[model samples]
Target: MGSLRLTFACGDYDRTRALHEGTVRPDGIELISLRLPVEETFFRMMRHHEFEVAELSLSSYVKSLDQDPSPFVALPVYPSRQFRHGGIFVNAAAGIEEPADLRGRVVGTPEWQLTAGVWIRGILADRHGVPVDSVEYRTGGQETPGRIEKAAVDLGEQIRIAPIPEDATLSEMLADGRIDALQSPRVPSTFRPGGGVRRLFADPVAAEKEYFTATGIFPIMHVVVVRRDVYERYPWVAQTLTKALHLAKREAMANLYDSSALRFSLPWLIPGLEEARALMGEDFWSYGLEANRNALATFLRYHHEQGLSRRQYAPEELFAPEATEAFVI
Candidate 1:
């Protein structure tokens, strides 16, 4: 049979650039990669099932598993991961000097189901003694208006979450102290140049490194998923795609070590790369289930604790069996 033609949609990241540029082709597959902004790709895939393969929010993927017929099945490929300590911004005058001060305060988030929000809330609760239900949560667009939760979540009575005014946004609310803090992946418009917003952690880089030391978790934000129908039709596609993505990521990582020239624009790129390797070890940005099991388990626990997932899930449950294991030579 001829190679299967499949559409894969995801953000344009260096790790996945090889796949997008046709430098790495999966076995028995003709990949058509559509590079789009994460928000657009996520909306189209989640709401309309637009692509055969796509990058999806980790929290949203976990939530979707509870559906009668889950919409998608994921590979063990993590396209995006980050330390979320930098994403939490608080009103400078809200008396919120530290994470604990967030208790009894109104915090705004773009959505309850956002992957970044999930990680930040979990970290606050686990490391900083701020429980998930301790603060009131306001959800709305960060800069624009009329944003709503994409995935339907039932928080029951334990969690307090509501929407900001239809005319208002989280950025403005945070800037003016209507909300005591904001947690989001995107920086608020008012955060720059004395716009009345500052990161909760003044030195977020230090905070993030400290957090990693304590928890050993570099939070995962997004995963590659295959539409359920597509997976069912070609069971082997999962493994093929997983292998191709792993190869692509390896090439990207290897490129950073070339001392003759800079692979990225940063002035101290070599030092930064060396520092990351020293701290996290090689294969820091890893693919597959085994390498990331602990982190994935932590995220699933957080998803359940924050009322996003119905119950805690094993990291193994998130990906297809084909994608979870590899053939031994």
Candidate 2:
């Protein structure tokens, strides 16, 4: 038979670039990669299953796992990983000096169970002693008006979450002093100069490094997933895709370390890369479930504790059986 043609959608990340550029191909499969913004890819995939395979948000993927037949099964390839300590923003005038001050305050988020929000809330509660339920949660578009949750999220009574009014976006609320803070993966446009907003951490890079030093976690924002039906029919696709991603990421990582020439659009990139290597050690951005167990477990815990998932899931339960294990030479 000829190669199976499939629709794949994900962000444009260096690790997955080889797949998009046709440098790596899954065995007997041809990919038509749709390089859209991550948010567009996610909503289309989750709500509509718009592609045969796509990168998925961890929180919503787990929410899918709770259904009788989960919508998709994942590979260990994490295309988007970020340290979320810098995602929190507060009104410059809110008097929110630290995380503890968030208690008894109103916090707005695009989605209550957003992966970034999960980590930020978990860090606030676990590391800073600010309980998740201690504050009221509001939902709305970060820059535009009236955004709503895309998937089903039932956190039940301990927490209170409400939708933003039709007239205002979360960023507007933050700027106008209606909400004390906003937690989002992207910076709200309103926070630009004279916008009356500021990040909770004045120096977020230093804060993120401090957080990494303490927790040994660089939060994973997205994982590659295949529709369950596609996996059920072409079972080999799971392992094939997994292997291809590993090979692609290896090339990406190797390229980033070439000190003779700069591979990215930043100055002093070599020293910055060296500093990261020195701090995170080798395998800093590893794939496969085993290498990321602690980070995955930590995220799942936050997912469950925030009531996004019905129950906490171990890393093994979250991915295809073949994805969790591989032979490395």
Candidate 3:
């Protein structure tokens, strides 16, 4: 048989490289990496029919599947450490003490439709008694109406108006005091100014825990998916790839600093890498079948409720049969 051709799409090039070098079976798998912007990668996958297996954020993947669900099937790969979303960084001098203080505040965000942003708005509106329509929302571009719509539906009229900008940096805006608070998934170190940016309350993991408690679904961050036809033709590919990824995760975790330093040639990640190594020691990166199914089901249910998708396909329809059967709940 000819070598199996596989392609991976990743958000971080360095992580992708580490996974590629550390995990993939070189002999049987002809793994190729593509460098494409996240938004453009989705369209390119549709246009070129390029990859067999692709890595993608579950939100974006669901959006793509909503456009056409037949070509792709999402597979669970790894679960990232839970991180807070919509980190509201306020100028220390703003005296914004509580969530209610965000009223009439100018907030900066990267993506308007991002799940993090939507969820943050929902929590703030529901818990803080803050009027949803009273705050001003700014996006980098005018092409963020969809995100706005999602937020509006989730938050009601509590969201007042939308601001579009040709070129605006949230960090710079925060530093210059152009915006009162900036919301993002994670706080970048660069965002901290002398007395400008200070973090407000973030949705604790308990909130996410409650979400899981209610729905049996954890919000999916990223997933591995393959074309439906490709899986049909290459039955063994699923097991092969999963095993390879498991091995890769193990090796990478064991030698996190050495591997990361070797790949990046920088010491920036050394400390964090050591911490991650210690934290994730002996913890396998691979998710069992039941865990992945639940995550996907939760994601699909969310998108459906939000009107982002219409059809409700089963979890089995999104992965190889063996993979579906591999890790029974």
Choose the strongest candidate by lDDT: 1
Candidate 1 TM-score to native: 0.97
TM-score, one value per model? 0.97, 0.96, 0.65
lDDT of 3 by residue, 1-329 (tens): 88777776654543345556544474477777666665555445655656777765555555555544456665556524243433667766676888789998888766655555544565566556655455787654222332222222233453444554446466666666777777767574445545457777545444444544554444445666677688778766676666555555555655655752464556666765565445434342436556456555654554444344456655555556665554452
Candidate 1 residues 192-235, lDDT tens each?
74557999998999999998888778889999999999999999
Model 1 is weakest, by summed lDDT over 10 consecutive residues, at 320-329
Clashing pairs in 2: none
- Best-to-worst order by lDDT is 1, 2, 3
| lDDT (C-alpha) at residue 93 in model 1 | 89
Higher TM-score: candidate 2 or 3? 2
* Clash number for each model: 0, 0, 6
The lDDT per prediction is 0.91, 0.88, 0.57
RMSD of 3: 6.1
